[model samples]
Target: MTTLRDIALIAGVSGATVSNVLRNRGFVGAETSARVREVAQRLGYRPNPMAQALANGRAPTIAMVFSDLANPFYSMFALEAERAARRRDHFLLVCHAAKPDGTLDTAYLGAVAGRLSGGVLILGSDLGRADLLSAVPNGVPTVLAMWEDAADHPSLPCVTLDFREAGRLAADHLLALGHRRIAVLAGARGDRVSHGARLEGATARLREAGVLGGATLEEDSIGGGHRAAMRLLEAEPRPTAILATNDLLGIGAIQAAGERGLAVPRELSVVGITDIWLAAEMRPALTTVDIDTRRIADASVNALLDLIAEPDALARDALRIVGRPSLVRRASTAQAP
Candidate 1:
């Protein structure tokens, strides 16, 4: 195997100089740095990450933990975060917490603790895992994605969209079209941040409009959405419109409507959050809310970096990053028939 010593000898520089060039540490002349890099590349000298971490007393890698990656909504967010991390010359380690029963495994907490460095980003946490916040060693910053408040851990920064506003917007759009009866397809029961805020916003809007009925909370999946919509459709006075918490549920609702031989827009209108790629290609293009996943991801990585720089700053103040949602009108919604 080609070693740093070999590269340094070929580049006519000291081994320490080569190490500095590779790690971008201690200043080296531009010409010397370039020569060292070329020699290292030609020799295929791969720097040992473990040695680098030990020498620097830290790892230049961040960790991201999410409830579920299957949901396109979360997938988009992950992609954005990954891109942003890469841009900053950092590595991202993702941890999937979604279990078969849709609950987080506490065992992963130990794994996350073991790789502590750079920072940590958590999505969709619950009270059961609240204790894990304390496990984060002091000085290692953390960011909570899509959570409303950082329960006992005020030290952690939070980055999330205005989920309540998203819900209200969905309800308001349906109500504006003269649809008195509406139902909401919610995410998992324990998903407090995104799902809770959305459901509250919808319910509040419905009540204010005076034509408010009720909503059905379901999992954030196609199957869950189909079942929720199916039950709502079987009600005495079926809803004329449905507000799905995410695009996956919204698409599933549309599929359910088709199976029941119902005509979309002409009979029922479906609105979904997160205008993902597939939304536009549906049989009837969906009218949904656009949550700029890329922007969110970029902001999240920046926030994590900021936290790493000043972990105490996050502990002293709350950082709430809110992203706006814009409605994309399409063939899926229309005036009440």
Candidate 2:
């Protein structure tokens, strides 16, 4: 098997020089560095991650923990994050926190917490517990994405999206369309960020408009939306419009309405949050709130880089960042029937 030593021998440089050139560390003449890189590429030399970590006391990779990778929202965030990391010359390692049974796995997280330099980014939800935040190995910084506030761990920084405002926007848009009976399809109640704040905002808006009494809450996924919408449709006073917390739920609600022989925007209207790409291409082109995942990813990466460069800066004192959701009008919503 080809190794760094073989590359070094062929390039006529010492092993130490080859290592330094590969890592872009210490001082190596430009000509020597180029020669080593060319020879290493030709030999297909692969650096041992463990040895590199040991030598530098830090891993070249960062870790990102999310609830589900199958969701388009999370996938877009990961894509933008990976791009941001590459621009700064770093690697990103993704870990899905939920197992097949949909339970949090702490043992898996603890096992790989030791070998990372660029810190960790938690997306979708918390790390299953507050204590887990503090348990991050020393020298490993942590950041929360799409979460409101870190209660006990002030040291941990966060990049939040205004989910509450997003919910309010959804409700207000449907209300303005003259829909008095509006239903909300929400994420799991356990997910405090999206479910709690978002629902509260929608509720507040509805109450002010005297429509809160008729609103219903459903689960976040497509299947959940179908079930919940089916129940609502069977009620004495069915909702004229439904506000889904995410686009996935909104799409499901549309399908459920079709099964019930209801024409969209004629018998029922639907609005979704998170203007995922697919939302615009749906049969009626869903009306939704854009979360701007790319912007969130860029800001999070930049904030972490700043923190890593200035360790002593107070966490709160550092810039607090959030992305705002904007309503996008489409064919799925119209005046209430």
Candidate 3:
């Protein structure tokens, strides 16, 4: 049987759009609706009786609560996740469950978990595992995602990448380029996903190579990188390379280098982790570690749906690790001068 996802993959439309177009419920533009219908017909599509019954019966959206949606990385993952959930016949509800001070709004999380679509996937926030576990009532399926530390097994189901490896890859790439006077511009604590684990991996790799790479903590934004890089460039022995924990910071550093009259890869080199799409579009494309965002999102949604199906599996720890961070060396990095 051709699933909605199968049609979606072929049609290049969202699962929700396919559902809406087929059911003739939501308002999809004529051109799009026609295309979806045409694909459905070609595939000899027939709706499952049970699926139709479920559509008439219960909530259809799975909540994807994030620490901060403002981050492009989260938005990128959101797109992938929405597609993943739609493929499974589940709509995605994105909730920013962060308080003003940047902590998980446990009350908000408790209110939404497993209530819709019988599952929820929470991304990284500044909440402790105990607090994170406590938010969702027992028997409600939940999965944590975008977790930086793959080794810190929380007492909940999760889908994460080896972030430490991502950090190490960034450092190794710079080291191989003969950039020794490097600066580690780390993201500040507790906003979006923390980069401490990634930082640790990079610093560890630098130490192993006998280079005591100094670090600076800045907000995990391009502006923050600009500020830190502007200062770092002023030092007596300027850093030839900078390893930002996130792509935003790395881009900022690149801009800062340009403002200082330094040409990227000629006088200054920079690398970042989490290969957001923007990294490639930048003037000097960033050299960063690809964490495989779409894979994590797809795996996370699949894991949440699995939890909904197998309630008993929640008795023990459940972890579904996906994605390996590898270096994507773009124009931003080159051999040290």
Candidate 4:
């Protein structure tokens, strides 16, 4: 096994310097730190996490419980969270609490708590508030990355996006572009769901413009968007604009439009939320509401770290961090034809 000493020798530094770089606990020269990490990576040197945990009396890992592993939005959040954790010399243990049907798997969720030590971050949920909270282990520092429509846990801090505002912004943009016949594609229809919040926000703005809008509840996937778009595009008075709940759905909408011989931004306009990387690269380039996953990741990580550093603070007021999303206009949206 490659040891710290081996990495130090390869990087021309002392083992203590290598240790500092690995632990992220002390200051090390930037150049030396880079060299040590590079050499360690080349040597495939992995610290024995269990042994280190035993020695330190705590794990240097963060547990993340996600409701939807398939959702691109959640997937992006996971990637950013992993990146943020690595910056703190920690690794991530991802646990999927929701099953394929979007219901909470209580047994799996309860089992995850015992495996975690340092901190936990919960993102998205489709279960009852009580059940979700009950599954989470108490006494562990925890942060909620996405706010759920449930009673808040006293010990958990929350970092979330202004999803309603994001929805409003998307609607305002399409309305400003003079598209009165608008349709929103979302996962569900209810105030309790985040998708509903976005829909309501958009509807509020659309209503103000004297444009009655429509909504379709679908799977919230690329395929779902495609199927929904096919139906919407075939309606008597086809919607000139579509607002998807996410980028994946937006891409699907674009595809559906193409299949119907409609040109984007000329015949049909589309906007999406979450601004995933693929949005900018898609044909016609998706106009989207940027959810700022990086900022959310940073806030979630910082909240967890704060809880880990000061457990007593959990007894005080809970910390609430909210990120605002902005609209990114691209080639996909234009004035009504």
Please list the C-alpha lDDT of all candidates, in the order they appear.
Answer: 0.75, 0.76, 0.85, 0.80
Q: What digit string (tens of lDDT, one per residue) describes model 1 on residues 1-337?
A: 8888899889999999998999888989999999999988888888787567746665667788776676676777788888899897777888785566545565665566435556777775332344545545555577777664333334467776776787788888998999987877777654443366767777898899996556676766778888888887887777889889787788889888998888997999999987887889897888888867777678878888777666565653466656697788887888777
Return the clash pairs for model 4, or none.
none
TM-score-superior candidate, 1 or 4: 1
- Per-residue lDDT tens digits of candidate 3, residues 1-337? 8989999999999999999998898899999999999999999999875577456644567888887788888899899999999898788888888777666787787777755456788886345566576677777788888776767867888788877788899999999999899999998854444687899899999999989987898888999999999999999788999999999999999999999999998999999999999999998999899999999999988888777777775543666769688899899999999
The sequence of per-residue lDDT tens digits that candidate 4 reaches over residues 1-337 is 9998999999999988998899896998888889999999999999977667756656778888887767777788889999998898778888887776556676776665535547778785454556556667667677877663223433356677767788899999998888988988876523344476677778888888999887787876788889989999998788999999778888999999999999998999999988988899998999999978899887888778777777775543365546678999999999998
Ranking by TM-score: 1, 2, 3, 4
Q: Model 1: which ten-residue window has the lowest total lDDT?
A: 147-156
* Top candidate, metric lDDT: 3
TM-score, prediction 4: 0.79
TM-score of each: 0.82, 0.82, 0.81, 0.79
Better of 1 and 3 by lDDT: 3
Candidate 2 per-residue C-alpha lDDT over 1-337 given as tens digits, one digit per residue, 9 for 90 to 100: 6777898899998988998899888999999999999999998888787566657666656677787887887888899988987787677889886566455566666655545445777674534455445455666666667764323223567776777788889999999999998887776634333466666777789999998643445556778778777877786688899888788888888889999999998999999888888899899889998878788898887676665556654374243556688899998999999
Q: lDDT-based ranking, best first?
A: 3, 4, 2, 1
Candidate 1, superposed: residue stretches over 4 Å from native:
5-54, 98-107, 112-117, 125-138, 148-155, 190-194
